[model samples]
Target: MRKPRDYDSELKALELKARQLKSRRQSQLGELVIATGADALTSEELAGALLAAVTTHDHAMKEAWRKRGAGFFSGGRPGAGDSAGREPGGAASGAGSTPPPSSEPGAA
Candidate 1:
């Protein structure tokens, strides 16, 4: 008769692999944030921006972003007018000139 499979060990191995993959994904996302110069934003601002992007229903805006992202991955310079023909605040904005939120009094 064939030996029974070690389901418990296989399950544990799969769980470990999942955790490792998740960690790698998070790291890559952090790197991408830095690469895109979005690291300048505070955590709150970043989260808000991501939430907006995720919740947006504008197909045209999403498509423009997708094309810009494709250009970025295909060796295009970051913020180099790759988003020409996009909305006014697109590519040329270059990571935004607005200062990050400050904690100090009268900072604004």
Candidate 2:
């Protein structure tokens, strides 16, 4: 005969796993914010900027923004573009700075 399943223990284990995943996600987001130098802005400013990006539909503008974002993540300076009118020292200032400390307590 097969052994009975411990449903209560299984449920608790699943909940714990979910909590761990959530914590990891928050930690990663915090790191991303600092890495992008977005921590300089207030939450409202960040939300507004993201909302604007989400709502924007200009193909050329979006393409340019995408390139800038790709460059930012690839260890290249932002706005180091061939075109004109880009910000002088926008995201690049923070991109090369030291990474922020981890948010997790007791992290080395």
Candidate 3:
């Protein structure tokens, strides 16, 4: 006869894997924020901007944003022509500043 499977252990393992994946995603997001210099924004500003992005229904705008994000990953930061993260008529913000220390333990 074949051995019986331990369903409870399998379920627990699956849940643990899900939690690990979620944790990794959150860490990557935090890294992305820092890498993009968005960490300079206050918590309220960041939250509001993220909310706006989430709620926006404009596909073209979303595509633009997506392309810009792809540039960040493929190239370095956005180019001089890119205006997404700049202040109006001003030099790029957060250009040469050090990012604040991360609160998470073991974060570099």
Candidate 4:
């Protein structure tokens, strides 16, 4: 009767107070952990959200890795396929075949 109703109100008040305290303490509270009454989101929603985050992070990481890789080759921007053009001494770039030692060494 009245006792049961009072207990319900007290429980509701305590739950609300705890939620308020938690919200005040956390910055990511803007994102909801659960709905008030609706069923939890489906696996599809969770997967899609996770994929979007991964794709964004992956793209950013790839751009950074590319920049670092380009820097490794040129110490600056790598030109239009210039990394494949030629070496400093113009030997078709890359670790080319090391030429054999000269045989006619001072005619000796």
Best by TM-score: 3
For residues 21-108, could you state the per-residue lDDT of candidate 2 as single tens digits?
A: 9999999989877766777677898899889999999999999989877877777753333222356545453443424333344455
lDDT of each: 0.74, 0.71, 0.72, 0.48
Model 1 per-residue lDDT tens digits across residues 8-107: 9999999999999999999999889876767766889889999999999999999988987888888875553445446454443444522332334357
Put down candidate 3 lDDT per residue, 6-73, tens digits, no spaces: 99999999999999999999999998877676766789988999999999999999999898788778
TM-score, prediction 4: 0.22
Off by over 4 Å in 3: 76-92, 96-108
Q: After superposition, which runs of candidate 4 have C-alpha atoms over 4 Å from their true positions?
A: 1-5, 28-108
Candidate 4, clashing residue pairs?
none
Model 2, position 63, has a per-residue lDDT of 99
Instruction: List residue ranges in candidate 1 displaced over 4 A.
Output: 78-108
Give the clash count for model 3: 0
Residue pairs with clashing backbones, model 1: none
Question: What order do candidates take by lDDT, descending?
Answer: 1, 3, 2, 4
Q: By TM-score, how accurate is candidate 3?
A: 0.74
lDDT of 4 by residue, 17-101 (tens): 9998887867333332221110133568656755765667577777875665567556453232344443352233222212212
